[model samples]
Target: MSRSHIALVGKIAAIACIIFIVFCICFYKTIRTGFIEAQFDRASMYMQGEGNPQDFKKAREYLEQSATAGSDNAQYMLGVMYEKGQGASQDFSKAMNFYKQAANKNHAKAQYALGSMYDHARGVPEDHTEAVRWYEKSANQNNPAAQYALGYAYYNGIGTTKNIDKGLQYLQKSAENGYVKALFYIGSLYFEGKNIPQDTKKAFSYFEKAAYKGNHDAQFYLGVMYENGNGVKRDYTKAIYWYEKSSKTHSSAAFNLAKMYKNGLGVEIDYNHAFELLKRAANGNNIQAQYYLANFYDKGDNVPQDSAKAAFWYDKAAKQGDSRSAYRLGEMYIDGRGVNENFDKAFQLFQQAAQDGNVQAQLKMATIYFKGMNTPIDHNKAIEWYQKAANQNNSEALLALGNIFDQGLDVPKDQAKAVGFYQKAAEGGNVEAQLKIASFYLAGTNLPKNPAKAIEWYQKAVDQGNIQAMLALGQIYEQGIGTTEDYQKAFEIYSKGLSSHNADLQYAVGMLYAKGLGVSKDIEKARNFLKKAAQQGLVVAQREYAKLDLSNQVQDPNMQTVISYLQEAIKNGDAESMFILGNLYLNGNHVTKDTKLAKELFMQSCEKGFENACHILKTTY
Candidate 1:
């Protein structure tokens, strides 16, 4: 009875154990499937706002759960969210971790993300080798971004030796996959012709593709190509179109547009429109625009001359390391034109611009040091700055050096050094330097006299429309100093100076007419020439006019006017006029006889070196 009871109980116990094990297995399978499905469904719903409002917090929670459940898509999404702070605080470490997890599972986007993180040193030390490795892995899986990244790395030799062929191949793959940046890069490579054969047609094609996809850089480059006729025929119309599009975001495009408007390249020359575009570019922090706008304001070139506005734009460009703008601003400070007078500030700005190789600034610094502007005079410093400017072939600086050497101002006088500097400046087209060189040669005072050389330099100055040079050249021709006497040439040279309204040229022309040296002597022409010189207050011309007897030839009113003009000239200390009036009084032609007055006038004229008056005085008194 005990054996049968024990065997039945053992069989029942074994059946119970087997049923319990089967039930536990079924429960585990149902719960695991339900948990994974629910996590994924909820993450997708929160991420895409499907059937609910998008909630980053909820999305992050569900994505984390799904990622924990081994969902590669969820891991990649979590990486993006963490990186961009979309569904959580921005955490590069978390982003890297999630990206690594998904990347291990062969997720292309996650691999690309990991590559970018390594490339930029986000959440890790920069490792270009690691970045290239990840990019290659993702690129092999047909990831367009990764393909572009790998191509750039090859092109730039980021992690390996540069290979243009491999770089272009990878870039072509990315472009085929519709990567806009890759198309732009390929266009730039072709356009720049660096490490690749120049192919404008190919560049234009790639640029067009990216530009149509709203790539601002591609559009800007397309404008540049059109404007420069590099990748297309020179077409300002097309350039304007592309530049307008890119100018929405690119300041350089705006700057180029302003130039086009100013020069009428693509549009009618409209200074106001150009100014507007320049302002826009300057507001966008374009350094060149800032400098040019400052110049426009400073010079009142189509804008009101507002010193404050000029200073503002100059400061903007100067801060960006524009040497010309810095120098201009320094000038404004020194002259209190557009800024408060601050010698110290001006010196600082001049020094900065001088160091930046601004020739004008170097000259200004030399002048400041030499003149002791807000500082002790420093001749050595002045010499240093002047030499710097002279190295750039600045004519003014050379002229200053010549003056310093010739005058022996703070240095030993050296006429040879002065002549050398003057020659250099003359070659650089400084008219004053040419005059100085001519004087040195003509007078034989500073160097060996060479009238031929003097004539050559004088002619150079005359070519530049220097009145003094013209007069000197005329005198040389009249005196036969350098070449054979040619009265006709002398007359021509003197005639050229007539346009300058110089009194000396007028007097010379009148004398030529009176003497009949160049043309047939005509009394009317001589009188007209003398009248012109007299009107300009030439004493000799006034004296010559007074000597003419025009009481019957000229009307009484005209004679009175001439007499009054001569009297005025005498009052102004015209020695020749005094002599002529003394003769008139002595002859009693136009006034009551007064021998005392006539003698007094003769004495005054004789004292001022009137040779005729001196002779008359010696013969009579």
Candidate 2:
């Protein structure tokens, strides 16, 4: 070829070669695009069950291949497959990975999915900030789920500073987008007054919407609103209807309904229904329901009483520091009712109860210390507990303290202190204290001799059925100490006192009968009364019984008694009996005389503060 023609041919050949290269590149691009499209189409077909045997496994495989080829939609689908285990094993880690890829590409659904994963800490450690970032991105794109999530984060301050106004703004925006979760969240916020002014009407409206959509929590809350008359008229039937609806899915609603049934508050008493509901709640790990169920078993009010079952529940509650359960365990240990009787175990449980401020336990500890029952007597500790109970206005503690001072049992003898305590107990309307105050006045021991005051206090005690007070009133009337001498009134009072089963009262009655003060002279009645009193450690009755002459051979029962009254008196704390018995020993009235036995008896009576026996022991002996 000519030089110019050869150059033109080389240029044309170069242009042709360049055109072929461009066509080949376009052809290779088309084939690669077709391959990726085919992979994604296959996944879509399997997902929709449009071709082949609607296999999620095949769909996952195709979706995985497409996702590996950088298809954002395919990646999102793959993530959903992994999340739901649709043809693949449920793998949160892999699901999150695929979702992150699509989320990075600004895929709305993927962004929401990844945000939920972070919100719930499903896959990785919960990073709320990351979740909020993705949610906001998708929410800005008008994704309804993302909008609801962003609102939740704002309302709860999950990943950002809490802003009630902003939270409600975002939630309202999501609700406007037809997001049901946003509506539910708005209801919660309104109900709790967190991100909105408390508006029960608005809350109930939103809750009704979510509840209608089968949200168990919303249904439960709506039931509560109706039951409590919040933003609605209280309707037990409607409340029960909604609670029944929620109970199918929510355990708390079942528990609340059970309580209502058990108490007959909003429903008829139905122990059987309550028990069934409680069992459901307990299975759901409702702690309060567990405690109540245990109590039912323990008391057998509605079920068979089972101590073992009670211990099971008590053990569960005790681990949670329930004081009532601890107290029950203590009682069990103390009495060996359902467990082994162990004082140490009881003490430990009682200590736990005391720490919880149980007043009865404090009193129990005081009694244990005071009586030294199964433990050593600790007076100081007893005083400490008594003081504790006294501060709580314990009636027994007040009376005990008064007695301690009056008789000097544990503390030093102080009539002033004794009067102070007795005054306290008397002010509390203690009958015994009223009578004791009356006695102090009658005897002129602590207060000045004031018969009027004595009679007034005695009348108060008499109103409380104090037999001693009646006897004292009778004496006052007989002696004209506080009132005019009325023999008939005194006789009536003494007759009433004598009818009591109390040993002291019976002895007082015997004296009145013997003296013919209350009723007509009846020697037979006097002996019978004296015999009853003698069995109760009354020294005077024993002395009177010893004086009765049983040697007479008479037809009457009084003169034909077999036992000597003197022998009965000698068994009691009678100084005269001691002298008589001593003399009997000295003179050998019924046996040989023993000088040592006589001396010993005189010394014993003398040491017992008997003046006559003391004189005999020092002089006659």
Candidate 3:
């Protein structure tokens, strides 16, 4: 009993000593942590000038003390200060040290900061995969910024193979955690709908969230959605409201608001406010706003015409690689409207825009090179630019190329290639090219003489009000060139051109009526048409009108006039005119009696199937 009691007492004493020692150690740590927290708080207050004037030097001293005492928050803050050069000269290497200290304790923001250092190569070789690994760690701890970084990396395949669905999931998580950029970016994806099904309502929802959270782009899009009535009821008032909010910081939003004021879309037409807002947007480097502002000045639409101001804005936007603006500035330079005329400068600008894929600028470059404007003629460069524009389906450029090949203008004549370009231009709605292709089809020049194709292309031109095409199509039907002689089709086609006062069209229509070819033989219509054609001095119509007098249709007929008409008609091989003139000679009605002349005229008329002349020749002769 004595041995057991002594052993138990010793054990109790030893147990109490261990408990007391452990309590003392825990108490020491508690007091030290409290001291460190106070030091960190003082440092934050000093840095932020809260309740005192800011003193970066004092803040750094306090932060260093707290950080050395193993406070993760203090360590992270000191890291930011060193990394950003806040309290002293920047030292990313030291920042990396403090950030590692805090990150080792699983501080989410510190982990994110460490990832950012590696991501941006701050005191470390840039390593996106390494950044992504840390981002995943912080994201697992529900750090919204880390989640956003991870999502962006996945979205763009920066650190891992691209996975839109996975990226979208992480972005959704970040947005749910109130990351404004993630909200806005996700909203854009829904709005664009290129890789996903378009869901405007869903996009509006995300944008609304981001807008309220101070995302200017989201605010601008909200205005757009409201104004366009996309995924929402049309409410210009709400649109203007959102636009005004975003316009404070976003140039595009200001530009849109300016348009609403200018056009009186949902607000009073206020040119003053419109101009002010437009200038604001333009000065802010909104490319479209700059272009429109330049146009307003150039055309004097709303403001005083200031060519210099227009050129200024155009130059601004052109420097930003706006093709349309570059081309416009080139024109101003060429015409000396805003600056001293400099063709070389203009051509340089044109080439800039042409290289940027502006179809009009491409065509202009082609024209400049082809015409040797401000430079030696360079058909190769011209062809290059023309082909670029033609590739974009520019009808003018296609037609020009066709003409180049067709006329052998500084290039070897290639009828086959010319036909190909002409066909392309015609398909692009170039009326001249349509007519060219039609003529080719009709004449079997470069293209087969397919009447159907000719008629098809001619009709295309006719629909565009081309009188030449109308006349050509009319002649095709009238003369039965490569097809049946469709008099009715010919008459209809020619009638359309009568208003154009074309002598050929007038004569054709008259002949059709006089011969009872298309419409009924209306002598009055036939006479009116023949008179109009004759007044226009058509040689063919004059001969035909003279022959009409053999039917006794001319109102003021005289013997001399009648004799002259008959002589002209005989040359045209008219049997009736020959018989009438022969009778006049036999009777000496308009000339001295001459049986030999009369007999010769009668013989010619009889051989040409004039029954009356044949009867006279056999019985009276």
Candidate 4:
């Protein structure tokens, strides 16, 4: 062969070798891309259980392999698995790590997940600003969840400055994307009217949209609106419907539904159903439900009496900062009703409740200090607590203050201050304070004499069935002592005490009938009433009934009984009884007619200041 032909053949062979190497590189690239795609698809299929029984373990293994091969979807799935503990124990740190890997690659769901972790302090300390940064990145890519979170942050000034306009803009975008939470949040904003102008029609529209999408909070709000007729016709049936739907998961909704059943609203009262619903709400940690359940157990209302359970529920509510429950538990502790008596624990609970503005607890604190029941006597502390309760317009506290000032217990006697407190308490319908203020005004003691004011206060006390006040005010009206005589008013006031079993009231009413001072005169009625009082051992009534019996001139052999009654009256210092006895002896109506005995009785009657006897002696003798 020629030298030129051998050189050409070698160059062509080198060119052919270069072309074969290029083709092999292209073929390898195609196969590698397909392999990566296959790995991602297999992992996704396992995660979704597309053709086999669900196996989170297998899904997680496949996901780890694809995630290591740089698949963003696989990284996002692994983040979810770690977050939810589907294949292993939940670990927020691992979840955040995987989320960051996918988020760095601009995966929208992963970016949103990372934002939620920062927002909620899942693995790292919560940082609203950082959460907003990630949320903004995802929201810009039209992620509905991210848009809702960004809107909420803006509306509450959580991460960014509060801007209602921008918040509403983002929320509307998310709502348009069918995000139920955004729809519910916008409705709440309108209903609350704090950050935005309240529009109930708009609120109803948004709430209804979210409710149809099965948002429990939206359903609960719809129940409230329907029950109250807020931007809707009041319909208890609809309210119950919404409440039943939300009660599956909403504790407050369960409580409200229980109340409706208990109250027979739009349904027959079903106590059994109400009780079951209340138990469900209580187990769900509803604070109000716990408080009411405690009350039911404490009072034994429709349930077996169980003081221990009552105390348990009360303790639960007290731990949640319920002042009323704290006060009730304190009462049980101090009285040893539900638990062993512990004065120190009771005092501490009372102080806690008092500090939380419980008027009854404040009164308990004041009484403890005033009486030195468990602690050293400290009138200054007592006064401070009493004033705290009085500031809430508590009548008992006001009356207590009046007594303290009037009696000079802890300070110099201040009649003016006492009267001021008494007046306030009286105005608040306290019977004891009304009596105090009335006595002060009637006697011109520490107050200018005002008959009208005295009568007004006395009448107020009498209206509350105060026996002492009723008797005093009735006398004033009948005798024209403080005000003009109004026999009808006197009779009305006295009539209220007729059934009190009081001897004084019975005698007074009898005298009214005898003298026709109030009602029409009826001798028979007078005698009957006087007999009733006299039987109860009233000296005055005994003397009066004896006189009534003698006036009827009854020829009974039991004359000694009437005479003995007059003698007993005279012995008790009723001077008028001497004159009546003297008259009886002179007339000899129910006794022997003896002038010597009659003259002796008249002398005694005159000496005892009986003017009728003196007149008989001067004229008839």
Give lDDT for model 1: 0.89
Q: Rate the local accuracy (lDDT) of all candidates.
A: 0.89, 0.79, 0.89, 0.88
Model 1: residue 522 alpha-carbon error in angstroms? 4.9
TM-score of each: 0.85, 0.58, 0.75, 0.84
The order of the candidates by TM-score, greatest first, is 1, 4, 3, 2
Instruction: Encode model 2's per-residue lDDT on 383-464: one tens digit a residue.
Output: 6776776777765677777777778766798889888878777777888888888888877889887878888898888777
lDDT per residue for candidate 3 within 23-103, as digits (tens), equals 999999999988999999999999999998999989999999999899999999989999999887899999999999999
Which tens-of-lDDT digit does each residue in 190-255 have in candidate 4?
898967888888898899999999999999999999988997899999999999999979989999
Quote model 2's TM-score: 0.58
Q: Please give the lDDT score for candidate 4.
A: 0.88
> Cα RMSD to native, each candidate?
5.3, 10.1, 8.2, 4.7
Q: Which stretches of candidate 1 lie over 4 Å from their true place?
A: 1-52, 163-165, 197-202, 268-273, 303-305, 444-448, 516-526, 547-577, 605-614
Count steric clashes of candidate 4. 0
Query: What's the true lDDT of residue 268 in model 1?
Result: 95
- Give me the displacement of residue 341 in model 2, in angstroms: 7.0
Which segments of model 3 are wrong by more than 4 Å?
A: 1-27, 55-57, 194-196, 233-235, 450-452, 467-621
